[model samples]
Target: MNVGEWAGLVAAAGSILGGGGWFVSRATRDAARATAAATEAAARANAAPAQQQASLAVLEATVKRVDEENGSLRGKMSRLEAVLRAFAWTTDRWSQQMHRAGIEPEPPHPLVEEYNRTGV
Candidate 1:
């Protein structure tokens, strides 16, 4: 071939090779991105069970603490009820003694009367 024809052939070959290289580079980059995404998804899948277990542990601990507090509150309520019973009994006795002595006792509050009636 002549020199000009040779040059043109060289240019055409270079253009084809360059375009193919660009496409190859783009394909490589896309494949790398897909691989990274798959790896990240796999890591998240592996961690999910551990994360759920952690949440379950937290919930169990909270339930145990609440149960303990409930027991403590039940004890406190029992003591309070005993105190109220004693107070009601004392007041009744006092009122009886005052009536026997011909002294008019002050009327009890409505709430106090209600508790005495209900024994609650």
Candidate 2:
């Protein structure tokens, strides 16, 4: 070929190779970015169940603690109720003995007065 034709052919080859290289580089970069994004998504998906279980464990422990505290409080309340009932029974027995002995118990206690007033 003549020098001019050879030069034109080289220019055409250079243009083709440059365009091909650019296309390949862009495609490879895009593929790498897509792979990175997919890997991050997969990691999060895999961890979700474990994270959920940890959260549930904390919730279960909290519920158990509350139940234990409530049970302790209920036991305390029951003992207090028993003590109060004993006091009331002893007071009533004393009042009955005083009345039978023909001795008036002093001024009625405030609780007795309230009971008399309300009939409760």
Candidate 3:
């Protein structure tokens, strides 16, 4: 071939190589980006279980607090019930004494009226 033809051929080869290199570089960059995205997603997936466990721990702590509060309220309710029972017994004894001495008994207390109303 003539020198001009050889030069043209060399230019064509260089153009083809340049285009191929550009395509390969683009492909490599895209693959790297995809790998990085997948790695980030995996990290997030791995952290999800630990986040859930922390949430469960908070829930367990709340339940324990409520249980303790419930126990304290139950104790207060027991004491109040004992006080009411003692008051009722004293009132009944007073009424019996008044009836034996021919005096009319006093009216029922508000709490006694409520208890009688509800039968609770």
Candidate 4:
């Protein structure tokens, strides 16, 4: 081949190789960026469920604690109510006994009579 034709062919080949290299480099860079974004998104997606589960666990624990406290308070109230009933029964018996012994039994208070009437 002539020197001029050979030189022209070499130049054309160099230009094509340079363009192809530039395109390949750009494609590789774009692919790498996309992969990185996907990895970050996947990490966030995986973390979301764990975060929700942790929050739910905390809420469940709080509910259980509140239920336990409510039950304890109810038990204490039941015992208090029983004691009050026993005291009222004993006081009523004592009043009746005093009346039978010739002692002047005081008249019941208006509030007491009202409560007794209502059975409250």
Q: Give one digit per residue, the lDDT tens place, for model 1 in 13-99.
A: 999999999999999999999999999999999999999999999999999999999999999999999988888889899999999
**How does each model score on lDDT?**
0.95, 0.91, 0.92, 0.92
Per-model TM-score versus the true fold: 0.82, 0.57, 0.63, 0.55
lDDT of 2: 0.91
What is the descending lDDT order? 1, 3, 4, 2
Model 3 lDDT at residue 104? 100
Give model 4's clash tally. Answer: 0
Off by over 4 Å in 3: 1-37, 109-111, 114-119
Worst 10 residues of 3 by lDDT: 111-120
Candidate 4 stretches greater than 4 Å from native: 1-44, 107-111
Q: Write the per-residue lDDT of candidate 3 for residues 1-120, one digit (tens) a residue.
A: 999999999999999999999999999999999999999999999999999999999999999999999999999999998887787778788889999999997798787888757744
Candidate 3 lDDT score relative to the true structure: 0.92
**CA error at residue 95 for candidate 1, angstroms:** 1.6
Which candidate's lDDT is highest? 1
- Measured with C-alpha atoms, the lDDT of residue 23 in candidate 1 is 100
- Give the Cα error of residue 93 in candidate 1, in Å: 2.1
Error of 2 at 78 (Å): 6.1
lDDT of 2 by residue, 1-120 (tens): 999999999999999999999999999999999999999999999999999999999999999999999999999999987876677778779989999999998887898677547744
